[model samples]
Target: MSLQYVQGASLFTHINEVPKQYAYLTQNISTDVIIIGGGVTGSILGYYFSRQNIDCVLLEKSRIAFGSTSITTTLLQYELDSSLRDLEQYTPLENSLKAYKLGLKALDEIDAFINEQGNNCDYEKKDTLLYTSKKEEIAEVEEEYNLRKTHGFSAEFLTASSNPFSFDLKAGLYAMDGGAQLDPYKYTHQLLDVSSQKGLQVFENTEVVKVNYLDHGVEVETTYGYKVKGKIIIVATGYNTQLFTKRNFGVKTTTFNIATKPVTSFGGWPGRVLIRDNSSTYHYFRTTADNRILAGGEDISFVPGIFNEDAALEKYELLEARIKTMFPLIKDIEAEYKYCGAFASTQDNLGFLGKDPKNDKLWYCLGYGANGILFAILGGMMLSKLYLGTFDENLKLFKLDRFDG
Candidate 1:
C-alpha cells in the first residue's frame, strides 16, 4: 500500500527483499531515550545510541522505512539545496562552510558505517556535478566553484567547451569525492537490524498518540494504550511534527522521481557520476547498480497536489521525458517506477537538530532538505553526544529558531 505522503511505487522498496517487522509495543516501558520515528534518521539514532549503551526504544506508526523514506531520490550530496552565494543571505558564509564541512564528516560517518555493517544498500561514492545548461546561470555556478576552492575544497569548473558529458552545459562544478547515493530503504533496515542486536528495542506499527512533559523528563503513550517514559524524547517524525509543536520548520513541497528499467548501456553518463542541475527547480540524475537511469525533480506546492493522482502522473511523465531528452542514445527508455512525495527546505538548506529551543525535554532530529540523509548522519552523531551532555558547537548551524525574527 502507498503511504499518504508517497504517490507511487518506490524503486528501492519494490526491488529489495521484505525486511523483518518488529512487534508493536504492547506493554508500558521506560528507557533513557524514546525515539518517535523509525525511518532512516531514527534507525541511525538507534544505532548510535544503542552502541553507546543508552537505553532507547524506537517506535514507528507504520512499517519501517515505508514513508517518505521509500520515495526519496537518495542522491546524497555535501552541498546544500542553496548554493554558498545564495545561502549567505540567510546565514554567515562561515556558518555555511561549517555546515558543508560537517556534511563531509557525515559522509565519512556513513562510509565507516557501511564498512562496518556491510554494504547491502547499494552504497557507492561518486563524483558530483552541479551544472547549468543556461548561459545566465554560469556566474552562479562559478561563484559556487570559487567558494569551494577558496575554502580549500577540491572542485573543477567546467563550461560548455570543457564539458565532459554528452548533456549540454553552460558551466558546472565537477567535484571529486563530493557525493554519494544509496538505497535509503535498505540502509534503514540495515541499521535497525544491527541496532536491535545491541539492546535497542524497536517497534513497528506502533503509533505515538500523545506526549506529556514531566518535571525532569518526558513520557508518551501509544495508540494501543501503552506508556513509555524517558528522560528525553527525540522527534524524528520528519515533516509530521505538528503533534509536538505547531511551528513550521520550513516550506514543504512535492518532489517527483522516475526510474527507468535497467538498460544495457549508459551513454554520456560516464562513471555514472551523480548530476544535479543548477536551477531553482532542477532535475537530478543518477545510475543504479542494476543499470537503471533515475531522474527526479519537478517540484510543486505541497497542498492539493500531493493528494492528486492526476498531478503526480503528469510529473512522472515530465520526469520520463527529461530522462529521454538527456540521453536519447539509450535504448528501451521505459520508466519502470515513478513516485512523488513531500519534502521541506529552509532558506539555508539545513535541517533542524539538537534541543528544541522552546522545550527542554523535547529534542528534534528533523533532517529536511536535499542533504537530508547527510544531515541525519550528523544528527545521529551530534544529537547522540548532546544526549550525553557533550555539545557540538557546529549544531548552532542547525538551530531550530535560526530563521525566526
Candidate 2:
C-alpha cells in the first residue's frame, strides 16, 4: 500500500457532505485491465476504459478519494510549472507548444465529461494568471506572454498599471479560459461511480500485496489473498511505487495549502480569477465552489510532511500571511482548513505516461507535476485507445524512459 499523502481531514472530504463507499474485494476477479490506484488518475482511466466495453477492475488500498486526491488544491491550469522559455532548455519549443495544446485538449475533455455526466464536482473554467511581483522579472514574464501570443494562443499580457486583480503584479500572463478549478475528491468518486455502472468493478480497502508479470498477462494478489488476473496493469498510485519499478520517476516535495472561510463580498478580485506568483516559491491561489479562497505552494523537499510538525506549521503560517498580504481586500481571511501533502515533479515539469519501457504488461499514468490532472486526462484518452489496437503518437511525448541517460 502507498503511504498517506495527507495528514488531517482535508477540506474536500468535509465539503462532500455525504460520502460514497465501495465494496472490498471479497473474491478473485478476472478482467482485461486492472487499475492500481483509485485516485483521480485511476478513476479517470476506469471511466475511459469502462466506456470502451473493456472489463476493468479498479483497486484502492484504502477509501477512494481519501488519498492524495483529497488534499489537492484542484486548481487545473493548462500551463506548466515552468515557463516555456525555461522548458525549451530541456525540450524543443515545438514540443512545449504541443504540451500546451494538449493541456487545452484535456481541459476540453473534462468539460465534455461535465456536460455529459452533469457537473457535480463544482467544476468551472477560470482564467489563470502567472505573474511576478518583482520588477527584475518583468522581462521574463513578458517574454513568456509574447511566446504564447505569437503561437496563436489566447493570452493577454498584464502590467502593474493594467490588470483587474488587486494583487501585486509587475507583469503577468493571463491565460484566458486555459485554466479551471474543481473539487477533485468529488470528481474522482463521480468518475468511478459512473464507470462502475458500466462494468467497471471497483474495490476499496483492497491492497495489492504482490504483482506477477506473466508472459501474456499480469496477476496481482491482494492483502486478502485474492488474485486478480488481467491483460494489463496501470500504476496510478500517486507517488508511492517502490514495488512497481526500480527507476526513480520524479523528485518529491511537500507542498502546503490553506483554505479560508467563504467570503460573500466579491471585493477587487474580479471573476475569482486563478492566480500564481512565478517567484522561486511558486505560490498559487484559486476560489473554491463555495467562494472560499484556496491557496497553496510553500514547497520543501521530502516525500511526506507529517514527520515534521514544526516545519509544516511554519509553511502554513507563511501561506496564511502571504495570502493576506496579496489580497488585502478580501475580508475574514481566517483559515478554515490547512494541510500539506507529497507532490512529485520532474525537472521538465511533465509527467510520465505510456507503457513501461522494459515491461509491456505494465503501464504508467502517473502525472507528477502541477499539470497532473491534464496529463492524466490525456493519458486516459491515449492509453485507452492503445489497448484497442490504436496508438496515439502524442504518447511519445510522455514516455517513461525519456530521462534515461
Q: Please give, for residues 94-179, the per-residue lDDT of candidate 2 as tens digits.
A: 88899999999999999999999999899999988889989999999999999999998999999988978777789988889978
Candidate 2 local Cα displacement, residue 105, angstroms: 0.1
Which residue pairs show backbone clashes in model 2? none
RMSD of each: 1.5, 1.3
- Candidate 2 off by > 4 Å: 1-3, 303-306
Error of 2 at 255 (Å): 0.2
- Which 10 consecutive positions of candidate 1 have the poorest summed lDDT? 1-10
CA lDDT, every model vs. true structure: 0.88, 0.88
Cα TM-score of candidate 1: 0.97
- TM per candidate comes to 0.97, 0.97
What is the per-residue lDDT of model 1 for residues 268-351, given as tens digits with 9 covering 90 to 100? 777899999987987899988888988999999888433888888898899888788888778678999988888899888899
